[model samples]
Target: MLQMNDKKLYNDWAAKTSDSVMKRRPEINTKWEYEDGVVLQGMELVFNKTGDKKYLEYMMKSMDLFVDENGNIPKYSSNEFNIDHINNGKVLLALYEHTEDERYKKAADLLRSQLTNHPRTSEGAFWHKEIYPYQIWLDGLYMGSVFYARYIKEFGEEAEFEDVMKQFTLSYKHTRDEETGLLHHAWDEKREQPWCDKETGLSKHYWARSIGWYVMAIVDVLDYIPESYEGRDVLLNMLEETVEAMMNYQDKETGVWYQIVNQQERKGNYLESSGSAMMLYAIAKGVRKNYLSQDWFEKAEHIYKGIIDEFILTTKDGLVNVNKICQVAGLGGKDKRDGSFAYYISEPIVTNDHKGVGPFILASAEMEMLYEERK
Candidate 1:
């Protein structure tokens, strides 16, 4: 039986998260290109829960700082055409639908414009980035497909649906391991990157958050993709495969996933917050959507409980802090990330990190909804 303390814990954490965002305007600095998208996702979740006009206003104001009267995003570059950059389009679409803002529409169209010119492999997958040539990270699927689904829904683009299908089909064909039902972190189409596996085009290791992004992408995009489309079944299968593979790696003791998901026996590898939250969101939503059996909901609930108990912290001033979020993981680079167990653990962990926060809010939202429904 749940105690009063458990309820208080949830309420207190939610309130602190809301207060923290409300108290400060997220910085408009140029440190990283995706900062606005991350902040907007957080604000969107907050607004959804609180119905606070200020949260919406905050998101619009920050977006307006970069997007001009003509809808040009100040720091965005079409030449690069990286899929990660497309995430902000979701926020632009939201603002456009809610407010009928022309600037937001224009900004979204600018992102769409990149899709038109971006390079694709022969099988039609968008290369993860121009610099990374022939590589498609599981991370890129979420970054790009969510926006792809949104654009197809908003603009009535039937052709885009085919492209969306192709992206996932190509990704699964290249990255999925038949034996384990798990996806590799990336597939290097060129097979030249040192981390690339010569025969499979897969990277040397799997990273939890990378697959988490892919899982979240499929579930979220499925919401927008037309059910009648033949490709929808392929996506559903892919999502099932992802959940099945992920379930195998869940830590039996903690109900969370390892940073290097399959590396359970590796010394010092620990349960990670962002990936755990992503899996919880995936499983809960998968059950909610009937893509998976209701039994998965039990797994989702168990993991969410574990996350709150294990990763969540209350700061001295009452801020809800999510600890032990691995900073970032990736394949070959000048930095020599070997995609090994040691490399995964070497990444720094931080408190209340946005990577964990957005996913945690998403997981909490789904869990709260499920709990309310069961009650």
Candidate 2:
């Protein structure tokens, strides 16, 4: 249990942890990538909730490193048409809204341009990457769709929003397992990948973080969708359905989800941090937005506590750490990812990966808002 003083500090944990993430990187030395977007997204939430300029400043400084005077990202290449590249557009859009800077606008436009030509499956889901052709990964939903929806809401035609909805609905159609009610990590439409089931084109296991990415994408994208839009309910229904499936697999004793979500009885399976954090974040935001019932929030409260007890760590020097984050996972690359149960567990588990910390902070922000409302 958190100490009494620490309990009071829960309200500020988002900002504090976000700051910790900022201090660790503190520069634009890294490539413009999804990991940075994840952390910046958490910072964006904290800035929204707390009205803190420092948080905003940190965001600006970090982004300014890559987005220059002419709005060029030195390291980015649009020809790649990678869906993960779109993730950073969320921050670019947020930065533009706050500052009304043309550079940010131009940078955002460049990312949006990618979607116009990004390679896709015959059914129109964005391929996870240029290299992984004909593949749609659950991770890509959050990477690409959230930014797509937000971009359309900000600057694109109303009709363009249809493309945003297709990413979710189509991916769900392809990757969803009817028997388990869980989504597989990736779907290869041609079933050409060695990892994919030849007939189904689906990966073998239900990876928790991939589903976490999908769920968080659904809830976050719903923010930009108008209530009058028909697709809004489609997304809401998906959120409810996915959350229900997630809850069924959550370890009753630990209140955290396993890395291979549906395989709790498997010996090597363990509760993972990023996936667990992402799940709690989705549930909290879904409930706060009234897209889900309050009963879900009550259930999420237990899961949130479990996240703290299980993944969050404290140092003697007082820095907070997020442990047990899977360093990286993917399918069908030079690494030859097979996407089996063993492959999922074989990924390195490490501390303070942005994937885990970012969602943990985002989840904290939502929980804090709900707590304040009750008080």
Candidate 3:
């Protein structure tokens, strides 16, 4: 029952976002970073939908800040071997394909080279970063795997599929709580990190955004993985199980999710925006691709409305903003994030963070498409 104005929601927000981001690109970050990729990637989708050259221009202009004409990323260091750094490669890949710019390809090549020596666990999962040794984080899967799959599709060998599959399978196997089917934020393979359980090697709590990142990774990576690939079914099964588990924990009243996913009754834990948007995008995309049943559409519709009502806002300037986003969360950093319920809920909830805005736009795009097709 979407009104005509409802159909324009996605485009309006996208247009406002593109302009807002462009105005602030200089201050967004100093180095080549992942948050830029998150927002630009959403803008890429908007570009695809509307054929707006300005969206593409904004993406290229933002990236040019880091990528020199010689194709070197000025501030990026491969030696860091940080999986988070690889997230931007998705946008680079898009730029290379669309504009056939060699600089973009060479920049992407630089990121690809990092995985050549990126630290991995004994079972072959990429460590979250060189600093966090022997650890696999759910967030790393999205940062690394999506670009890895896309790179393999464009310029890699058939043998690379094994490496890609291991990232998803190994991360899921190690961190997933079998009973609940929800993954903890991270796992310390050596069980040495203070944040992890000494015996189980798993973190203490189920963080909604971490699980959200994991599910979003699965659906996005599936794009470049061929249907006939042997591991595709495994990824699909994992997606279904994780999404179903997420549904079981969704706030029935708000139709969103809590910061500490399973501890809904816990005091101070509130509904979160970024994670909810991530879930909406994954479920709606799954149904659109026919990987999920048609019956799931109603649920996707519900989530879309819920995200709109619970988190969206309008500025006095007539632009949109996403609020109530957990600014950041992680396990076992210098501050020793213990992955407890308090740790997840204590992060500053901010407005219009890229983590929330990008996913909200992506979700809106999916809902827009679904509405278009139904008409």
Clashes of 3: 0
Cα lDDT listed for each candidate:
0.79, 0.88, 0.87
What is the total number of backbone clashes in candidate 1? 0
In candidate 3, stretches whose alpha carbon ends up further than 4 angstroms from where it belongs are 1-12, 23-28
Query: Candidate 3: what lDDT?
Result: 0.87
TM-score of each: 0.93, 0.97, 0.96
lDDT of residue 281 for candidate 3? 85
Residues 1-375, candidate 3: write the lDDT tens digits: 433245444455555666666665644567787877888888888899889898898888888888999999989999988999999999999999999999999999999999988999998899999999999999999999999999999999867988999999998888889899889889999999988899989999888888988988988988999888999999999999999999999998778999999989999998899999999889988988877887888888777777878888777876677889999998877998877778787889998889988888788777777767876
In candidate 1, residue 283 scores what lDDT? 81
Model 3: pairs clashing at backbone N, Cα or C within 3 Å: none
Ranking according to lDDT, highest score first: 2, 3, 1
